[model samples]
Target: MKPIVTLTINPTIDLATAVAEVTPEHKLRCDAERRDPGGGGLNVARVIRELGGESLALYPRGGSTGELLERLLEEKRLRRWPISISGHTRENFTVTERKSGREFRFVMPGPTLTEAEWKTVLDSLSTVAADVEFIVASGSLAPGVPVDFYARVAHIAREQNAKLVLDTSGEPLRAALEEGVFFAKPNRKEFRDMMGPQVDEPAGMAAAARSFLEKGRAEILVVSMGADGAMLTTREGQYRAVPPPVKTASSVGAGDSFVGGMTFGLARGLPPHEAFRWGIASGTAALMSQGTDLCSRQDVEHLLTQVQPTRLA
Candidate 1:
């Protein structure tokens, strides 16, 4: 097994297409479609591979869509271990309006997981936890799973001395935070959802992150502000990064790319600030592609030169 591992309880096959205009009650014909294996941990693994790193993607799969998802992952050559479930995996659709440059996303809640199935996931992680350097568990919880699922994963990470990097929201996020994590990233929208609308400003966001850091809820609290940029707060100090200007085709997979790049840098023994710079570059690089295409190594390398991270403290 590779030293880096990612866990995704809910996975999906992302289907994307473009249409000229969206009108109510109109049968709008879309252009050719593209499908990709998606979900938080899977996307992160893909980005790590694009950056010349390897990770084992552990997720649950079921039915026809699940088979298609595996085939897509195979196409990307992602090292994966997919657990079989009774219900079919979900599919997410994205439609881009060419005229208005607007994107519409429709998501489905994934299949339910039985207690035995969820325990199997934990068992799988337990077997590999000590051997891995990081356990990245992201995405939303499916039905039939407890809210403390990630917190349970966090405990395994702590027990194995592996860093837990989380990218989730709501009660699952809060539960994991109570267990403490090495790194936790919540996009601006998710941050707002968790901390309320009052914490939307930069300073407010920073203060919120600082509170978590001071409370030992997380060693590093990163609030990812789409387009605006990202801020990182730690006990040592705080830093902010502004991504270089790039025309965006879609914001899909950008945050996952950030997690992948930052984890890749940290796994290579780089410090948090430098790792965060890599994250910004990766996220910017992701914007350089259309649809679900993640960041390429070349684009990331080039963008890394343009990333300027500032010490806020």
Candidate 2:
């Protein structure tokens, strides 16, 4: 099987710490900080690696934070190809309240990429995507990047005969769907925004997803419902997999882990329904981990046995 390729337009150095509580204008000491390479696609790639699969990650690098991101990936021994940009990479801060175990995330809009810089990313994809079986374009468009960027990525994937596994939201996601893709994963909030609030119920959401499939916009759609598990919609039918309960440490990377597991199963030639189970298992496993630790292979394997998906009428 060919290696999976993942692209993250706006990568970040994730900084996490714990404090007794969060209050305005009060100086509070924090626990030792933990830094990790973060971004939707990067997290997916990391999860794939954890599941014993191979993937090549592509992302832009800039400034000192970019350098740190590279070193972090190296420590994890993830294969990567970095493109240089003039703007500084962004850093996201996560604070966990020790008393309540609640997490507060502070996200920054990533650096603005110049036209040339953004085009360089497209050019790189065109060059390396030919032999890959799947190309995952996840995360947000950075400042100065066009909304149609993922649409363009879909075009490239189609040209290369690769399955495009896309995860994003808003205009970029809508634009990409216009170009069509092999699979898409959106959280419930993002799904509501894309398909309208009227499609909030399961039946309505299924109809909306099938409509897109009929139009050739996408072959499969999965909506991550956080602790409620996920819903998978394909042309053949619809299914829902609710994960077994686990105490959620943090919900940060659950979506990415789901994508990674499902994509990995697909690459291994598993049918869509069976692969959907892998996604549910991996996502549930993520809830069991702390910070950005993501899902462990043991946990995923254990959860896989517990997941029993039911067909939706």
Candidate 3:
């Protein structure tokens, strides 16, 4: 088995285009379109492949859109295992306004999954995760899937002796934490919402995350603050990786890139603090690219020099 395996239950075909401007009630002509296979775990697997790491991406596929998604990932030469589903995979659209450089995104709730289909995903994980070091479950649950899906994944990872790295939000995240994961990355807002109103600042974030660690909810937690940077909290201590300022072309896929880089670094035997810096550099590098373009290996290497990680507590 590969060292890392990623799972995306709700995947999408991302269609992106650029327009001169966006105005209500006007027909806006768009530039040439670009399509990418997108979803949290898929993006993570893509970024890992871009960084010269190997990982297997596991996700559902159906209909013509799903077929195209598979083709797109194939073009990128990403290793994947597609679970067959009865529902057509969803398509998400993004239009970047060239004049204002603003992006407008239309995201569809993904296709519903049958009970048998989701159970199939779990069953597959039992086999695929048996020898993998890390099982990265990222993205949302599709309609008709339980909110405890990732929690179930965590249980499988535990039974298989694999570390579960989760990147998601809302009740699914909360439930998964109850089941416990090895690591979790939640954006600042999501972290705040999950931790409640009392965790209004970074100071409180460390304390709350440590509490989770002490309770065995997670071994490590990361709160990403976009341009501000990200904080890593573990039972041992807290560290923050801050990036040098750079102009951001697009924010799409940055978070997934971060998770990919960090997880890849860990798989490569980097210490937690150093892996946190890799995540910061990779995420910042992703911001330097235009729509749907993730960070390249060269860009990540260059930005690695610009990331400075400091012990917070």
Write the number of the candidate with greater TM-score, choosing between 1 and 3.
3
**Model 2 lDDT at residue 29:** 92
lDDT value, candidate 3, whole model? 0.91
TM-score for all predictions? 0.97, 0.98, 0.98
Candidate 3 at 271: error in angstroms?
1.2
Best by lDDT: 2
Global Cα RMSD, each model: 1.4, 0.9, 1.1
Instruction: Please list all clashing residue pairs in model 1, or write none if there are none.
Output: none
So what's the TM-score on candidate 3? 0.98
lDDT of 1 by residue, 144-209 (tens): 999999999999999998999999999999999899999999988888887777686678877877
The sequence of per-residue lDDT tens digits that candidate 3 reaches over residues 124-231 is 999999889998999988999999999999999999999999999999999999999998999988988887866676677778878768888888788899988999
Each model's lDDT: 0.90, 0.92, 0.91
How do all the candidates rank in terms of lDDT, highest first?
2, 3, 1
Measured by C-alpha RMSD in angstroms, how accurate is candidate 3? 1.1
lDDT of 2 by residue, 168-259 (tens): 99999999999999999998999899878756887788888777678888898898898888888898898988998888888878989999
